[model samples]
Target: MGDILAHESELLGLVKEKDLVAAFDNGDQKVFFDLWEEHISSSIRDGDSFAQKLEFYLHIHFAIYLLKYSVGRPDKEELDEKISYFKTYLETKGAALSQTTEFLPFYALPFVPNPMVHPSFKELFQDSWTPELKLKLIKFLALISKASNTPKLLTIYKENGQSNKEILQQLHQQLVEAERRSVTYLKRYNKIQADYHNLIGVTAELVDSLEATVSGKMITPEYLQSVCVRLFSNQMRQSLAHSVDFTRPGTASTMLRASLAPVKLKDVPLLPSLDYEKLKKDLILGSDRLKAFLLQALRWRLTTSHPGEQRETVLQAYISNDLLDCYSHNQRSVLQLLHSTSDVVRQYMARLINAFASLAEGRLYLAQNTKVLQMLEGRLKEEDKDIITRENVLGALQKFSLRRPLQTAMIQDGLIFWLVDVLKDPDCLSDYTLEYSVALLMNLCLRSTGKNMCAKVAGLVLKVLSDLLGHENHEIQPYVNGALYSILSVPSIREEARAMVP
Candidate 1:
């Protein structure tokens, strides 16, 4: 025992000196495996005291190594024996452990390296367990999945198909139930956040795996959307408990940025719905500071990009959340604010209009609101120093004109002249900005009323199209052709358009 203790102490020291991750990275996995074998052999023979002294961090490292390196290799009898022995040791220590310590041992079971060792990793999960423990295990599995292309959890399921179906269903049910309870009963915001975070994390993996491998109905997009709404409402409800001052610079903006950080789930496109009425009345309606903060936050969220190496380039959930849609339809109160005389207010409103224009519903709402359309139209004619404001106002008009009724309203507001002016401007417009312009004209010329509007500006329109036809950009060609076809099909402008074709 004395010799064994000394050997164990020496091994632990060596492990501590050479970190497990560094060892793996340095290609010393075989050496680490040897140390693991020696420690297990010494522990089983040297008694519980020596086993207890083996240290939790050492076990964590071993588990990580199993996950990191133990796949696709042929079965080893010696490794099987040591892992079986280690499982027994772990089971003995796992009773009623706290969440902090429970995950350390539990994380090892699914990634035990030997196919035979974790044949029942799924069974262990679906079996009765504490909610905290279950959530921790689920999060660990998700992290493993996200960290690499091939997760051991996924590998186990792939190799063992029908056996895992029931286990996965059970896990899905548990996650749904846990998410409900967390939102409905949990009062502590941090705890609720952590629970849902893990729940959604597991959900992302489960949804991705089942979709690729299984064809049956597991989790629907609608169900995921509901879960998203509940989580958002919970966060907002908690945030509303305190008095947030929107006036101080960064006060309202900072609160919203932190409070509304997008709910990210790996491979999931679901986003939480925002109650625009509640958000506006409580946060933005009467306060300029709050509204400005919201405007800045929206700009930040829209423009921010992930690290270059990340798998997903954009946050689809944030884009689909539609807070701006809500704000745009708030009884036209937000639109009324757009007409403010203050230049800062006008810039914020312009940016808001640009965001609102991204969605069809928001554009429809703006089109129906006569005052808003007039204000956007007015901004288009004014010569502003800030080109972004003018560009955004035109962008909003393009989106609004996509709807036929809105196009009629916008034509009445003199949108045709502005489109011709921008198209003929000497300065270059971005391909996307140019695309929006051409696309809008294409829509307008589809009908007789708009065709007549095009006829009035036919000479200028033909000149711009003739120039664009010779331009290098190929994307703009289709829209230019569509607009030209719409105009030339009209007997009135056909000859004039053809005359400029050369």
Candidate 2:
């Protein structure tokens, strides 16, 4: 979390020397791994001083390297377990491993044994000893003791030395926060990387489960469904996607691609079976539990299994040209998931809703049940806790404004107020957020309800619209112009707009 310690040159130098790692590499691995285990287990504890704590981290940094060596590769779980344990300690206290422990021997100087890690080299001196060697050994000991005591010496001499505790606490706090953020970013990177390749893993079944919360293990029904969002990099997600199928790209890109896959299908391929059922009996009567089951069956097939067949197939089947009894009824289930705290869950669920809203039939279904639409608006209106989720929510709401009914409903919920507020401080929003939010605003503003709503706060709306014209992104211009045209349509707003002119 800070600059590498002074001792890091030696540690990094050792890792970089693949030749050195190779030289130490051999048939017998138990000794190396065991020594690594013992040294790491015993030495990895909190230190009393900053320097001592730093030194301990240097040793741990080297131990992690030991596990990464190619030849004696232990079971990956062993590495994962060790690192997980190591990270837990780092998060709670700080990362460290004592250098003074009399475990794991090594040679730090010419025939000068390191009692901590280089003590094994001491045997070399027993057989071939010289007075000059003995003198050099005593000199080395003096230097080692002096080096080890430097931290204490600094503490004793420095003015206001008592501030060390305060400094350590602040530094450690910063290090911990920095480390937590770094780990979060790294995990997010892996997740996005994995998702980008989901289309390529079309042969896999989509599984969504968890092992640990790095991203974490799933305890839900989906915990082990089929994702390999594990610790390993490229290889980890790839293997899981192919064999276990733990994740499916929530985006429609994977759906479109996998729909063309060579997976097996029944003679009739049950999904598209009910699509053309024009018989009067085919219509959904009461709650249509059978239709719900059919849609549910197809939902998992498309999301969690190989593209056996049809998303559009299920769409058309579940919502016949004359029927949508099941589609609108399922909004309650959709709402439950929309309120999910998980970005993973919410993102995927949002995608499904996006699919639903893609067509006139789907839009009609959504209009009948504004609960899903309003839920999305509520989440977007709240604090921006997760960017991806907000992007998704904004994207969908932006689409919803295309329908006048949705526009009226959203305006009634005061969506225009929030949109204006967001545009007022565009710097905090991502480019995608800006684009989507602006686009949605323009669509809503075009509606009579949106225009009237803007009229109430025409001055603020005009200021936001005018300010956006100067924005760096050229894409928001069209939306800004449309919204300006809509806002200035009202007579009172038009009067105010003209009155503000210089």
Candidate 3:
């Protein structure tokens, strides 16, 4: 404690009022040097004691005033040396003070000696420093820079400040360049955004037109050709498929056929018949155009269309193929779809089966395919009794029975039993189903082989046909009579039918 007091008294002696006033009055900074050499130099070098540290900072405050006033105009080298000494003192001891109340006051002062004295301040603009430290150092340098530009310190900078000015100017130019680049990039981004919106609008317009054209409104082959041409490319096709809503029933298939269908040449008196081969070649490169477009459109509809209508539209269009061979190629997939848990798929399967039965080749194909025959029989045997499926099965059976080979297959597979069972379930069968079943039965009994098959189940057949005689569906009575008359034609089956009469 005594040593600290002695140090404090000695520091006070160095800055005594008479000596400081005389030094200023005489315009002599030698007194500032005398104060530094006498008491401050050693204290700045080894100022670990609190009193010595306080005296050292007091010396720095006096140097700041001396530099501010230029009272004696210290030599530039001498001023730099003094500032360098003050910088080392502050750096070595500033950290402890930074956490105390004294830091803000010291930081707020405009006179910061020279930023070039501290290494951190010297690299203030370098990115290697932490952002927090760089920010603090930048503020410190800025305050010093502002003070250095003042009338008292302007010459100090004019003599040796070229590097600092250049660093600041370079930073300003870089900021300006960065702002210009940002503006340019922003313009490009905005243009791209605008173009994207315009493209979206154009796509939406095309989708609207496509939907309207597909709905059978203003549908001409040429308009469809134009639309397909517009959507011919894969990218355009994908976009059109995704953007257009085809929820309206049958629209997708209708559009597909409309797009790919050949233009029919109107017959004229003088003109030669239009060469279909050349015309078709010109219309589409491959016959697979229909297949490809149909597959693509059906896949799209599978995702977009309502559950019930999807298979119906696809199957209906599939049935419209000109070549039975072409339809047969896709029959496996259709048969697989028949087994779907969706009632919608099963219903459409029945419609497709009815359509196939209406074609001679399709009926022969179905009758020959035991898998198809079994599927039909299974559908017919369903206890829940779907009327449309049963009706279609009967229609298919009637077609098959017309061909002797198919009739034999039916008997061998015991599918003829399904017809008799349907006939027996008059309470369950629809009027259309009853008519179809009786018609199938009439066809099945026409031949001796089929007669033997029915004779095996003659009691049940006779009973069901006899019950149908008084059916309120008069449409069924004629078919029932025809079936019974055919059954009674075979002598042995006829005797058995008579025995079944109530």
Candidate 4:
């Protein structure tokens, strides 16, 4: 106890000193680890009530600090060693506390996983002292079980006398309860309902429970088939479509994104051995439903005027793809939706175009069916002759070029002619508009077809640059200059610049 007090005093003195926290900031992992080790070790040994609480608090604080700093290239060996030591320390202290009813709360504290990695520590500990700890422990173990590939922990649990049937039963019961509670809680927090695995587990339990309650004659495979058919039928599609516009920015879209936020692929649950084949078959057969959901989700990406909504929509689209096969024929329905609503889908189309340059080139090609491009061409307005919203327009143009550079060359020629006409408009030549227009033109000029297309756009670029040279917005000036520099860097545009100088 005296040694523990001495260490606490030392920690306090260290905290009081100038720049103690700066040791963490300076990227000195060893010092940060040592500070945490000493504090945690002392607290564990002393077992002072206040010190025990402080120990848990500091463990979390230091763990988060270390994780945040050590994100790229963490010291894995050192981290494992520290975790082993910490776990050993906790076990010793927990064993001591288990001997006394008064120390049961500390048992709860020890079980709370570090919150930085697992944010549900508080909830996990909610019934820790109740008779339901075994159930809660089972849920906790199951959650981690899905994440753990190694069988060491499971083997240990089995050796300790936990039966497979008990484990499975506990999991099944916890999921059943979680589903019931989630429905009630979702009225206030919709995100809990949107989580894919949570929904899957709950739905599976509902099906199982329903099956068990029915008479043996009524529980035939054909009956089960009819039930699934009804559940995923077109009526449900209409119901889902009307319940919330997954396309319009709303609570549902937000909740869906929160639920499907990426987890490490390995951490996601492996398909159960029995259901793996059925899962694949269901995914293949249910492609149409997946397509509808994606299209509606894409619409939310389009109609959402807010930047936050736009970002979330992009992320959700990525997540939705994880469940559906990328090359599935049902993707055509999504493209058809995009084609049918070209004007309303402009923002999402533009985003898709930009994304293609990075991650979705094949999807962009598949999506830009001739019908979609024709719709885009039809939507071209006289005002677009000047490249207002040119960044977005150019992104779309770039994708079209990628899809069909030869066929798009003529369209490019026509667009450039309009760009020159718009650039020559005194009223259309403002700093903001010209900056975006010139950048778009520069992007176009960089394209292979746009090489031959550059000569015609050069006069407009030179005129825009000359006007922009005296603009007052310092930010706009650099961008305009950069665009001009890019255009001049091209051989044809360089000749145009020289021709004008002479």
Best by lDDT: 1
Model 4 ranges with Cα > 4 A deviation = 1-296, 299-358, 362-374, 382-393, 398-413, 423-436, 447-451, 469-483, 486-502
Pick out the ten consecutive residues of candidate 2 with the lowest summed lDDT.
104-113
Residue 145 of candidate 1: its Cα lDDT?
Answer: 30
Clashing residue pairs in all predictions, respectively, total: 0, 25, 0, 1
Q: TM-score each candidate.
A: 0.39, 0.39, 0.35, 0.30
Error of 2 at 408 (Å): 1.3
What is the model-wide C-alpha lDDT for candidate 2? 0.54
What tens digits encode model 3's per-residue C-alpha lDDT throughout 444-468?
Answer: 7776777788888778878888888
Model 4 TM-score is 0.30
Could you give candidate 1's per-residue lDDT for residues 1-502 as a string of tens digits?
A: 9779766766664454344335434435356446444534443424433233333323333333333345665246644444454444444452212134333334234223333334333333332322333344334334433433355698666657865786799899999999999886766776766766555555555556577657665554444434343444475745543444443455533554566667655543211223344444523444564455445444443444232222122233333443434324555455554665566666777887776676654565455556677877777677365566667776777777767787787676667767778888524776656777777777777778888887887788788877878777656666787778678877768878668656
Candidate 1: segments with Cα more than 4 A from true spot:
1-289, 298-332, 341-344, 426-432, 498-502
Distance from true location, Cα of 159 in model 2, Å? 58
- For residue 100, what is the lDDT in candidate 2? 31
* Comparison by TM-score, 2 against 3, better one: 2
